[model samples]
Target: MSGAVPLNDPRFQTDPVELYRELRRDHGAVAPILLDGDIPAWLVIGYRELHQVTGDPALYSRDSVLWNQWDNVPDDWPLLPMIGRGETSIIHTTNGQHRERAAMISDALEAVDPFTLRQHAERLADELIDSFCADGRTDIIGRYTMLLPVRVLARLLGFTDEQGPGLVTALNEMLDGGEDALTGHGHLVEAATALLTEKADGPGADVVSRMLANRGDFTVEEITKDLLMIMVAGHQPTADWIGNTLRLMLTDDRFAASLSGGRHSVGEAMTEVLWEDTPTQNVPGRWATRDTNLGNRRIRAGDLLILGVAAANFDPQIRTDSSVLTGGNTAFFSFGHGEHRCPFPAQEIAEVIARTGIEVLLDRLPDIDLAVPGEALAQRPSPWLRGLTSLPVIFSPAPALSPARRP
Candidate 1:
């Protein structure tokens, strides 16, 4: 009735749905689990209970300062990269301060015109697709998915050529999470430090510039960390979301048929991906502010709480199948909820990027098919995120989109 499963266990990473589903069925929604360091945490897997925990900050808080494990866990614990963090993390902040920081980001994102966003998305997608479209076979991960998000984020942030790659690499390293995580985090801080320095001198019409001007009383160091959080949030998961959605389009028969029937919108397909294969399987950790109960499980003070985003989507508490009905499915935990909800609709952003890239490429090369069988496809081994390392596909060589469509 009570036990712990290793968060980094191979099956949890490689085949999470089946693995966590069993955890939900057997462990009853909230399963105490072990992180990489044998550190303890609770994994919330049921839809209703996850909502209960996430929506009520009075009971569950993201303030990492409340986390009790720090007393027992080492300062250099690997889980710190993903779970707990400094005072500046927008993702880990709460309530009024959370709203303040989120507003700064939301206002900056709102400044980017929809038309201009799409125009840049299409141009970037077209150019990248063209580079590999001629090869007749390509790895979508490198050529398209991984690069598209960073490119768009760079333009939105007003990053120069040098700054773009620096941000991307640093962000990737942080999320990639291994022996180099501390180094990667150092690089991210360095990149953010430089950007903050540049913006302070002579601010431009960009997200960073806007954030700097709008920040109420955030110190420069705090603003730098906030920017790093925004950059990583904007690019990494969205890139993975696109890749997961693209793979669904290629492999799922029902999804593939929708393209021929003209029955599915990019948003619809993207929603389905989020339901079945959320980009973030587990998300920013929450700590119980006081002793509480969640789905019959006693949550003690300072206990770590992780919403099983992917598990909640499929939990019997909600019907995922109803997504096929007309109006579209809204029941998803991919973007999270409550005071900490992602201000920008990540799916909408992913849709904008994926639609342009997928549509432009599909229009040019219509017959692209997976080079390997669907069964051969495998997700990379990370407990917190679901993503394909690559989706190899073959298609008849087609001429690149014309300059008019491209630029």
Candidate 2:
């Protein structure tokens, strides 16, 4: 089971849906798999069963401090950034702690008026398009999908453009669990500390400022962790969502002909990406609170569970035919469930960001087309996420914008 079931298995990585079906047939919905270092855990693939895991904090906990295996696990575990660190952040906490932090985070993020943030996103999108518009070619991932989010997130958090690159790079390495994970994480810690110091001068209009304004209750350390958690939740995942959404537009004949051509609207297309090809296909390291039965499997306390959002989204019992569409269903577990649902709902954040960003590209580069066959694209290496490492595209050249008009 360990050998065949690790998601890193070449066969499973190449075409996960096929293997998910096979696993369901053999092991039912809750299948066992191996993480890095051969650590064993359950991979919950059924929609119903996953809801049981993600929604019930009483039975399946999120706080890593509660992990029964905490002492045994090494500090350098690669998946640490994915779920273990930032224990005090809303995403990492449970019960009352999560509620308190959630309110704090919501108040801070609300400073970013949705309309203004969307406009800023479009302006950044246009400026990025201008940079490569004359060349007629660009790697969509590097230039558009990835870069735009870092800029927008930086702006929303009151960080300067100069600070964006370093912050983005560090967060990317941390999430990818790359060879430089420790270095990347350390850089993030430094960046967060510096940003906190800068905000200390006085709270301004950005999320960081608002978080710092709560000095009466919030600690500088907590605010720093809150900022880091926002980066973890929004930075790379948003970029990956944009890439996955556009990948469909460039490949699927329906969307390729016209992004609005299919029955799925831009919102729905974005949702589809979140469901069928979630940027993070397998959410790692959700620990069991105690001996619990998920489906027919008895999971021991502290055993990590990989919520197979990608697998559960396609569970045959809930989804009869996903060949055509995904998302909008209450059953879709893409954004997660219960207290951990993305800070904003599907239409609220990911869809709005991706749809608005895509609209900007479609309007500015109307003639854009995929540079390579979809099958020719290479994926980033990870046991979890399924993302195009790069996406090359070509379009009719356009003139650069005047600095007067550029954001």
Candidate 3:
């Protein structure tokens, strides 16, 4: 493991694409990697190799209990929130159980009216912009992009408006993969369980109630854990999607037209971001069920394989010209692949929230521009997700619109 690349290296924050290229050049499709505490694993950066791994869940399982390094992992491991052990959530479940849980989640999300979802996003976006628009300048990340998705998701999931801020803080800490991860995860669990308890007697038309009403025979504890998983999975990536796409539009010349009432370009910019700067960069990941050979590397039973999603999207074999626009191409692994990929309804919900949020912001502030040099923008240091820590911007001062005003 001496030559294994450290997944938590500081350089990954600044130039992950270059690092991924280096990993591919040195280690081919599957590179040996060390996570926090120098824990050994494999980074699958090849597009085809990643597809094979995700497509064959029987060989590469989502159950973290099968990981070989758990014996050496300390009790306070920061990644425990991300790589949970023995959790009953759909992310860890496989085969029939996973299918049933996935179906339940899809059903609950599918029940959401798309128009209502967009209205929530637009209103929330307006409110967020109102707080900072008159100032002519704002850190869009803190004030807008980071706040929108979770708030919208909270309302949809039956949580009150007062609960949204706390949920945001907890999710950020937990997904950050830092010292506060466990504490944040604990808060999330407590919140989910409390909400489930409250909704037990007075079920509403929200996601939790629908989940409770499902005939899956899942226990309350199981449902609670699944809710936590759904919230975590839904919020951060969608938030990043908005932030990353915004960054692309404000800084890249190709997307400059989007700022000038070119609404058609917005979708193109988003698709391009998914291929290049995807929110969920590296998923920590499937475990080897038995000894196997993949991408010319030897593997043993219980070996951990981190899915290099962004890396796979940029694999030179598949993307011969990374500079070209992606347009409607969505063959990327941003939402993942195979049966464990993000549920279709969940993806659609994320799209509605992200697309609506961006469109509203652009419609309201047509001249918004980056407030700082593009090179000055920094991404969060976590290896799991790629998102701007803050997107400072300056725009023409505008009056806050009334609730009756329509964009």
List, in order, the clash count of every candidate structure: 0, 0, 0
Task: Name the Cα RMSD for model 1.
Answer: 2.2
Query: Which regions of candidate 2 are displaced past 4 Å?
Result: 1-4, 10-13, 259-264, 327-330, 345-347, 404-407
Give candidate 3's root-mean-square deviation (CA, Å). 1.0
**Across residues 1-407, which tens digit of lDDT does each residue of candidate 1 receive?**
14788877778657776787778777898888887777788899999999998889878988888887787777776556777555567887787888888888788777777788889888888888888888999998878888888888787776775566666667666776666667778887887788789888999988889888998888888788777777777787888888887788888775776455443555667778778777888885888999989989999998888888888887865764633532457668888888787776444565677667667666666777899997888776666778887889999997777787665
RMSD of each: 2.2, 2.4, 1.0
**Which predicted model would earn the best lDDT?**
3
Considering summed lDDT, which 10 consecutive residues are worst modelled in model 3?
Answer: 2-11
Backbone clashes in model 3, listed as residue pairs? none
* lDDT tens digits by residue: candidate 3, 182-213: 99999999999999998998999899999999
Candidates' TM-scores? 0.94, 0.93, 0.98
Residue 389's C-alpha lDDT in candidate 1?
78
* Sort order, TM-score high to low: 3, 1, 2
Candidate 2: residue 145 Cα off by (Å): 1.0
**lDDT of each candidate versus the true structure:** 0.78, 0.76, 0.91
* Pairs in steric clash, model 1: none
Off by over 4 Å in 1: 258-265, 320-327, 345-347, 402-404
